[model samples]
Target chain A: AQTVTQSQPEMSVQEAETVTLSCTYDTSESDYYLFWYKQPPSRQMILVIRQEAYKQQNATENRFSVNFQKAAKSFSLKISDSQLGDAAMYFCAYRRGGGGSNYKLTFGKGTLLTVNP
Target chain B: DTAVSQTPKYLVTQMGNDKSIKCEQNLGHDTMYWYKQDSKKFLKIMFSYNNKELIINETVPNRFSPKSPDKAHLNLHINSLELGDSAVYFCASSQGDRVRGTQYFGPGTRLLVL
Candidate 1:
């Protein structure tokens, strides 16, 4: 079974600054997908960004980017130019490549991020 | 238009009561799933259905049952609910393609079993 771990329980960052949320996973499969989901106080799960294990280049979406290190089994999310809207609970998820049950996502506990003005 | 939606955003019921939460997706996706977020904020997959067929059934309790009348709708029925069942339930759907199919989630149903 694959497991994702977010060591930081809580994190805070000043407005316009950058914040990095650490994530590490355990997977024996060579090909997989890693994702970052943001859950605001509204409790809506929104996709922040995603990274494919086969790709060496990190994935970036606007101000959100990921540091995907397949060798270290680490996939961290970096939020640049952080804004108040960035305050939320961030989760790291892992999904094996392929169809059927392999598509099921294995999620981490979560990291609550606070953006300070 | 809402891609995915869930009814009864807030559900407050007593223990031993039965409740049902409905989920629908207008995205024409062939796959739907049910996930449970515990009080500790841990989310886990409970059930998954594809094309009205049960595909993945996690280690969830038998008290919880998932019904998919069609590919666009997946409803969860919980019988004899317990306090431990109090948590936020999320309904999500994704394209059935073999590639990077991202799952889109609903607003979530907050269930409180008192």
Candidate 2:
């Protein structure tokens, strides 16, 4: 079974500053996908960004980006110019490619990120 | 418009009761899923239905059943609910084309088993 590991239980960053959330996973397949989801106080799971293993260049979305190291099987999320509204429970997820993979995702334990004003 | 929606946003029922949570998607997505978030905030896929057909059934207990009436709706029914069943249930939809199709999530239904 694939497993995502988020070693940090909590993280804090100053407003307008930058913060990085660590995530690693174990998978036997070389081709797959990685994602970062943010669950704010509203409790809605929002997709922050996604990285494809085949792509060497990292994925960036506005102020959000990811450093995906396929060899190390590590995918980390970087939040630049962080805002108070960015505070939420961030989760790292993995999805197997091909054969539909049941359309299921294996999620990490989650890291609570707090942005201080 | 909300891409994904789930009904019975909050459910509070006693043990031994049977209840159902309804999920619908307006995104024209072919794949729908049911996920449970435990007290520790662990989210795991319980079931997945693609085009009204069961595609993935995880290690979830038999007391839980998922029924898809059509491509737009997937409902979760829990029989003989136990206190351990209390948690937030989220409904999600995706294209499932194996081309980096993203999964969109609903607001989620908070279920409380008393």
Candidate 3:
């Protein structure tokens, strides 16, 4: 069994600033995947970025990048030049890399990010 | 075009009633899943199907049935609904269960059981 934890229940960032959401997970498997998902008022889940456990280099997409620390089991999402549109609920998820029961995606209780413009 | 879509974006039903939610993906992905989001915004897995074969069936109750007509579609049918069954259901698809591949999500269907 694997569990993901998001320490921040709520976070606020000023417009044009930077914000980082923290996430950690517990898994015995060596191979896995970490992800950040965003849900806006429309209730649509959008992929922010994904990081492979084997890849030490963090994943970056536009304003979103992650500090993936395999040892500490920490995967934090950083949003730079934050805008009002970035206000949403963010979730950290984990999944097994190999085939079998680990194929399913597990999510953490979301962190509410409020971007004040 | 929406890559993954779910029908009946909003569902309102009475207790003990039976209802079904349909999901379809045009991404040509071979794997699909059904996830439930509670009032607290906690997303949990309900079921998953790969290539039309049942794979991950969480601790979901027997009343909640998932049917996959083909590889591209997975439908969720719930029987004897309770107020606790009220939540937002999301449909997602992935090329495969590979680590590098990402799962695309659909606009969730909000179910309100009264």
CA lDDT of each prediction against the hidden true structure = 0.93, 0.94, 0.93
Candidate 2 or 1, higher TM-score: 2
Error of 2 at B9 (Å): 0.9
Each candidate: chain B TM-score:
0.97, 0.97, 0.97
Candidates arranged by lDDT, highest first? 2, 1, 3
Tell me how large the interface RMSD of candidate 2 is.
1.3
Question: After TM-score superposition, what is the CA distance of residue A16 in candidate 1 from its true location, in Å?
Answer: 0.6
Q: How close is candidate 2 to the true structure, as a TM-score?
A: 0.98
Candidate 2 C-alpha error for residue A34, in Å: 0.4
Candidate 2 structure quality by residue, lDDT tens digits, A18-87 = 9999999999997788999999999999999999888999999999999999989999999999999999
DockQ head-to-head 1 vs 2, winner: 2
Better of 1 and 3 by DockQ: 3
Local accuracy of candidate 3 as per-residue lDDT tens digits, A4-82: 9999999999999999999999999998999999999999999999999988899999999999999999999999999
Rank by DockQ (best first): 2, 3, 1
Error of 1 at A21 (Å): 0.5
Better structure of 1 and 2 per lDDT: 2
Name the lDDT value of residue B79 in candidate 1: 100
